[model samples]
Target: MTANVQNLNAERYSNEVFELWANQQNLNKSEDYLLKKYITDTSKHVLEAGTGGGRLSFYIEEKGFNNISAFDVVPNMIAHAKKRASTNDSNINFSISDAAVLENYESNSFDYLVYLQQVLCFIDKKDLFTNALKEAYRVAKKDAIVMFSFLDYESKIYNPALSSFVNVLRKLRSEEQSSRHLPWLKINNDINWKLFHKNQPKTYWVKRAEITSLLEDIGFSIEEVKNANQFSKNTGKRKGILYVVCKK
Candidate 1:
């Protein structure tokens, strides 16, 4: 992640407004389906990246997945997760971690890897995104299942005109430019959010073919790929979030 985007995301997620993640009670239909279908072993070691407020961690633990390790780059998020775990007497180990540089974890350590919540999109640069995927491959055991999710470039939510405008603006300023580099908007009531709204931070979007090719090149066997509507009844759109189930 670039320093500017990283700092922006840290500010966005660290705000108390995001602390509501602690009380997120259930997985969406897509997450629920993917988890039940590919990750059925209750005893396996599960590592969840970008575990905002421990939502997935808490759900899986409640479902009997005892060996769970979850992390996020934002310390305030991790603090909230740890506090929730303590309150619930949960066994999950919540920690501060960056997916692109997981120095604290050893190679071939986890049996299952969960990179959902469209966490990869937050990485606005391609090289750092690839590095993060490589880190996932390194920490996962051979043949371990890795579930990933990405923001779909084809989604109706992505406005091509806005993307083009952003590209032109950045190019004029001699900044890096791509159609996939779109701004993050304010979705909460943080007092300082308007400042960020004016100077928008970006998130990278991906297409199915692009991510499929990248994952295969990085030594993962693509097992399944589904768009939002295909994966969940609630999504109601064909081109929203994309989910992929892969193996090392």
Candidate 2:
């Protein structure tokens, strides 16, 4: 079953809320580095899974990449993305589709596949996640690249304030029980306060060894695994996220 939070009208949340926490820290530069480093210079076909609000898509467009496509499971989010695309006069394709299933698209049609922020964490099942990767590989060119960022579970556990807040939100969402088992979080309650609190999936803190092994098992060659903070020096003391790039 899909997470209850995924069923919520996420587009109702202001776009500003998505940027509020990261904007202050200049994390966009780090994200840009991940994009530039993994995305091939010759790549024209690109796909972004779970492209929420199209913030990163806009950045990709600004970097002059044409033939970009993005999709989100939430229809409202797609509506907002379409609106944003219209406002910006961008011709990028936007669609509403589940991340776990991309079979409708033609195979070997893309050169790069990107999953930004906590998109991986939002997928609740390991098989589903693996299938998504398989689909990415199928849709990408023989040597195409797939890049994504993930939270470091170790860092989250060590931070008292953040951990406490996370636990509280998880409790409110009724996800505390399964939080440790799955990467994605599900908030079942419709309470306004809980909605505002925002509980996210627990970080798997995927180590380089495990990630590399998974990639190899899934027919991908591991290329780079860098602490996203390395690119954004201002991140300071929060070694909670890593950017990984793998080739098909």
lDDT of 2 at 208: 52
Question: TM-score for model 2?
Answer: 0.73
Best by TM-score: 1
Models 1 onward score TM values of 0.90, 0.73
RMSD of each: 2.8, 5.8
User: What Cα-based lDDT does every candidate model obtain?
Assistant: 0.82, 0.64
- Residue-level lDDT of model 2, residues 1-248, one tens digit each, is 15543333232323323443122223366677777776656447889887767877777777788789998776656687888889889988999777667855888887888877757655555566667667777788888888877765544554445446566766777753333333223223233343224543333345556666877887888887767566656544546477678888
Candidate 1 structure quality by residue, lDDT tens digits, 182-246? 77644554434442233455677887788999999999999998886886454445666899999
For candidate 1, give the lDDT of residue 240: 65
lDDT score for residue 87 of model 1: 91
Q: Worst lDDT window (10 residues) for model 2? A: 180-189
